[model samples]
Target: MNFLIASVSSEPSIDHAPFILSGVLLSLVVIYLASKIGGEISNRLGLPPVLGELLAGVIVGVSALKLLTFPESGSDGSDSVIMWLLQTTLGLPASEVSAVFTQVSDVVLLLSELGVIILLFEIGLESDLKQLLGVGAQAVVVAVIGVVLPFAAGTAGLIFLFGMAPIPAIFAGAALTATSIGITSRVLSELGKLTSKEGQIILGAAVTDDVLGIIVLAIVASLAKTGTVDLGNVIILIISAASFLVGALLLGQLVNKLYVSVATNLKTRGEIITPAFIFAFAMAYLGNAIHLEAILGSFTAGLILDESDERNELQKQVVPVADLLVPIFFVTVGAKTNIGVLNPLIPVNREGLIIAAFLIVVAIVGKVATGLGAFGQPGINRWAIGVGMIPRGEVGLVFAGIGSSSGVLSESLNAAIVIMVIITTFIAPPLLRVAFGISPDLESKELKTEVTKES
Candidate 1:
């Protein structure tokens, strides 16, 4: 026992930890700067802040500045400027370059993963389960159509026209199935339509779409690993997803009571916030253990806790943590985005740009068609609802990131996916206002004008 204890507590990594820590700190600094600057600029321009962060990532990533880049083979890929910077800064020789890259990459990636989980948890806190359930059959239809049309159309189109393989094609298709409730809801609230029939329907459908998208993500991620998608595997995945979701919903209820009780009885510094995160992390781990995405677990935990008495307080606490960590996920995604594939100078770049254009068209059309799926609402703005669903936002980026990191997508497809995400997210807010016959720039300008006059 003593020998094992000593070995476990040994400090073999003590010497190397500083460089890795330094690399992480450096990346965080770049991520925060990129996120804040990009978000602020996007906001100033009447665009989604997430769009700015992504564009900022592109600026700092391998596409341009190369300061926030990742390469498969460290500095030797002649591709990883981030690795080169770290090596130079740490004064490491070629022998330690790979080691530094691997350790730093792992640490940064883990943090990014945690960021997404937290982001999902926050989304759940903001969601209203009763409202979602109340949206009823129209929401269910919209969600189903939104998910099905995009996945089927995108996957089939890529296979038939683009001549892509199955796994990567599936990954790309899965990317299309999500609706960013966070972005959509915010815009609706700004427009004073959040509680309207149209807004409620859109929100409910978006929530359902998020859940479906997560399942699709899990299935595709597995298919990406195995490089095949047989009917049996797919059926098994469906069963697993359904089972996990139902189980998590049920389990969350039981755990919430215990969590609330324990938190209430305690008077510690982290009385509420700490227990909340503990529950969130535990659920995330359980989800991963069951072959699902960890975000789904955290998301479900958020929904469960939304029913608690301390929902508002918990949300207030979670936001700061999300503000701290979520940018890492978004910036890293943007940094990994390699836009060089879309360059028109090279012969092959023409095809990439073409595919990207095709993807953009499909992404817009597939999502917009969901608006037509609304039934029996005599005067409801189906156009606005469809437009609302258009922006894939952070959720779409999650799919793109999965495809990029897993090596399941080709450079062209990954770049295409990123392009599609950027365009869809950028245009949705404006298009949604347009659907209601509001000028794309009117609301933003009117708000600023009013604020200035008031001041």
Candidate 2:
């Protein structure tokens, strides 16, 4: 009887494994399908692709029918099996099987980071060094105002609302200082203003703003962990960033020269393309080792390769990998977001929604102030420049993630940040169209010509 009972216990049963696998697979399918459908709908409605992707995430995540769920601990054997399947796919270890669905969440965050890097690289590739130089002064003024105002406003807001938590509030304010160039670039591109003087200034200013934002994030992160901010470390970070740019610029010149030399003798396209990705990845790794954001390294790499003869070929090769990795990031970000955590009945809970509103306002008003910095420039609408800088997209989420992981931001704060990101991104394209006077049936030829002249 004991032997028979042991045999019965050992018998495998078709349990929850299948359901878990199906749910994860369906989630990916849904995200992809949503991307396709959303892209079409967004373009037709004169909106950015990111807005569509976020809408899709909201639909699949919590706004529409809720298909995904974070399973409770001590689930049955079938639940364990399902969780195991998701963990396996996400390459998460068995130890974290209890939070199996979070694996999908991690992937999305990873992709979002990857997306911003590629987006920056593409912007670098498309930029004309001479044009950027010509607009350098204006860009500097705009970038400075853009960073300072937001930092001040956000910090003050956090202090007034959350009280005197120096570290958390500082970090939260730092998060708000970022201007996502991706959203701005998309709106400008769509409005046929990408090559305009104002567009060039906004683009260049954005690059500057991002570099400053990363430094602030690093300092804030360090302060949060160490309980004090080191002035020496902050100075070192600034020097390092300046050195990175100077080194990249010098290296880019050398690479351009070498490419010109080798272009005549090159046998295959792969020879040029392969080394580019190797360099890009290597720079990214180096950035991480130096305690800087990895995307900063990738962006720097693109800037170094900007004027190379092989730049186009390299961009082509790198773009495909970027495309695949990017969506995974977005989908994973969506999965990690637990909308159920928000409770309208609780006062602390209500604080999140209120904070979200405040952030959206800060994000909008901060960029708009950049237009004032462009005050003296002729034929350039300062309002349009500020409007272009409105969308936060992946970069804002990245800040939120860093804050949350570092314990600078609570779970409620992270959710509020996500909502702010989505709202700002959704509003940008339409506002940009209105600002730039772009018609629904605007042709690419006109935009292309404008872009060429700007370059």
Candidate 3:
């Protein structure tokens, strides 16, 4: 016993300990494996892969099984997974472990942020600007109506009923405004109705809704950060956000032209991919520099690149990176969520659930109202169009993450958003099939085609 004690005490002290390289690597392994298994299970169960990834985080996270953890409150906490692993592995104390884990957490969070940027970029890449623009006046009507009603309903409900502060309420309202076209398109393709007129209008309007939603998010985020809402500030945020998108597109087009000239003499494995990444990162950096979300910059970069002559080649190159990083982002989001916050026994959680229920109703009604925007075309089942617009999917999650990160949303509120996303996503496919009077048989190729378009 004496010898053992002496040997243990002779090890490096906490303050002098070296970084635990193994801990960092092991964390990655755990996160990736957990995410992969969860995603696969979710897919098999007919749910969005993101939902599974999130659940994986919860399953492995501190609030439940404690498989994954960070300091409960901030970088200073000793209870996180990183701290525990480093403490045990390196024979360091909890406080000393934080120094190293802080770096690790920052890396993970940065990668997660990058994941969303890539997500937005992927959305932009799959889109056809000309097709989007040609969606007609009816799509515009539907898109505008769809965005407005939801924003108004969500904001009003939160303020009048929930009594949430105005800034946070605005964020909540903004979260309600997102529509995931990817899910809608896939369901339409499954029904073999992707090429139909109603499908076209829904697709067009959903895409338009995304643009409007992001703009709203930008405004809300700006207000949240500024801690006050003023007309001049609102106008400036709008102008800056709009200008960044417009300017990025214009500059990207010019750069792409120059890139074509330079590419003729270039030969490298990552020739196309490298430049694309630089453009995206540069834009993201610029957006954040200007007090806007980096997603806007990356999204505009995608729009610009999609118009390039070499777009197909670039798309192929970017997929591998996206596949690797996007899941990490989703998994991190899940890991951060504390499922315990949603317990109905908790008064805040109970209140949040009630608000969430109301938000869902508003979400449904506001989107359903868009079907009426297909006015003058009585042949279209307007209800089906509305159903198609219901799922918020990844976009809603992204918005919620932003709100939570910016401190505009409480944990209970975030849980409510998650519940809203789950309900909307789960209901969309079946409701769409019923509305279209189609069989439930889904085509693998159709799903694949939409996936291809998205990447």
Candidate 4:
């Protein structure tokens, strides 16, 4: 049986440092086992392995086994079964359980965050910068329409259909506008469509969507907190996000010219890969400091490094690191999700589930229409473009989490948003693969062309 864990913010007992270390390692053991087993199962079933990894997280997480949980999202506790097991095996004192759980979960969360940065960097490395530039205009169109459609549709539907308050309806609508770049990019790379016209449009739009979504988030969150929107802050965010992307790209161009020479002279074991990480991490740090996503910075770093003579070598070396880290990210996103909100057996949950149904419809249809935004691309996979933008993933959760914590959302409304995120994030991968199922020869030719260019 699963347990709902309440959290306390306190320092770990120094005396139980060994027990804390054991807890973290144990959690990682669960994570790795779940990820690999789930991924392999999905691969065998002809679905994206990331899907299996996510489902495996759901199995081990709050929805099923209760083995993996996050207290910061308003659930999980120190006295849960994991803590009990640690106490039984490690002789950890009851007084130290909360601190240990917090420490271990915090470490795991950090690792998950690191995993995504590496994943985005790897994606950036694989992307054709020139191709991405070519589709930049279509991407902007896709991003704006993708955001406006979902936000407008969701907000209106809730207000008209369910009589939800304007503030809460807006927050839920805001959740729909996000596209998970990590998830979409991973699927594209696996499909060998990273260089295809459709793939480029998807990647560009997802990045653009994230920036615009963040701005929308700021506006909604501000609306939730204070009745009036801070026009000034919104303007600053717009300018800051634009400048960061442009500055990072321009700066990376200059820095990368010297980077190849610097790596050539280094004699250490990690000469090439080590310095690449240093650069990626620095950019990631700056991005976070400026309120932009860290993954954005890392992705930019990958794009910059991709231009170097050592690009192939960098890709080869980065894989081992990505293999070690990226699954953690996918798993944790699933693990943190509390799917209990959709329980049909409970009377109170039925209403939220019904609203979730509406949100889900809007989320899927609104994003699918975004494929049409890629205008003038003859014979392109419009459905694939739409599917690529479908998964709200972590970005949607961020919106739901903020809305819930800030008291702007009712219990039913919050539950509906979470369910919308879970479903959209889960369904998009397989749908994307199927959408790209044109004639086998043509698809294979596209892959071959991209491979030749990358090689």
- Winner by TM-score: 1
For residue 237, model 1's alpha carbon misses the true position, in angstroms, by: 0.8
By TM-score, rank the candidates, best first: 1, 3, 4, 2
RMSD for all candidates, in order, please.
6.5, 7.7, 7.7, 7.9
Best by lDDT: 1
lDDT digits (tens) for residues 129-190 of candidate 3:
77778999888899998899998999988999878888888888888888998889988998
lDDT of 1 at 12: 53
Q: Model 1: per-residue lDDT, tens digit, 1-455?
A: 99889989975543567777887788788889999999999999988788898899889877788667676312342355666676677775566666776777788878888998998888887778777678789888999999999899999988899898888888998899998988888889888888877788899999889878988898888778778879998898889878887876777667778888988999978899899999889888987887777877898888889988888889898888999998888888888877888899989789889878877887888888888878887667778878888989999999988788788887778889989999898888878877877523334556889999999
TM-score, cand. 4 vs. native: 0.77
lDDT of model 1 at residue 264? 97
Model 2, residue 442: distance off in Å is 20
List, residue by residue over 126-186, the lDDT tens digit for candidate 4: 7666655665779989999999999999999998998988888888999999887877888
Q: Higher-lDDT candidate among 2 and 3?
A: 3
What are the clashing pairs of model 3? 60-68, 69-81
Write down the TM-score of every candidate: 0.90, 0.75, 0.88, 0.77
| Clashing residue pairs in candidate 1 (N, C-alpha, C atoms within 3 angstroms) | none
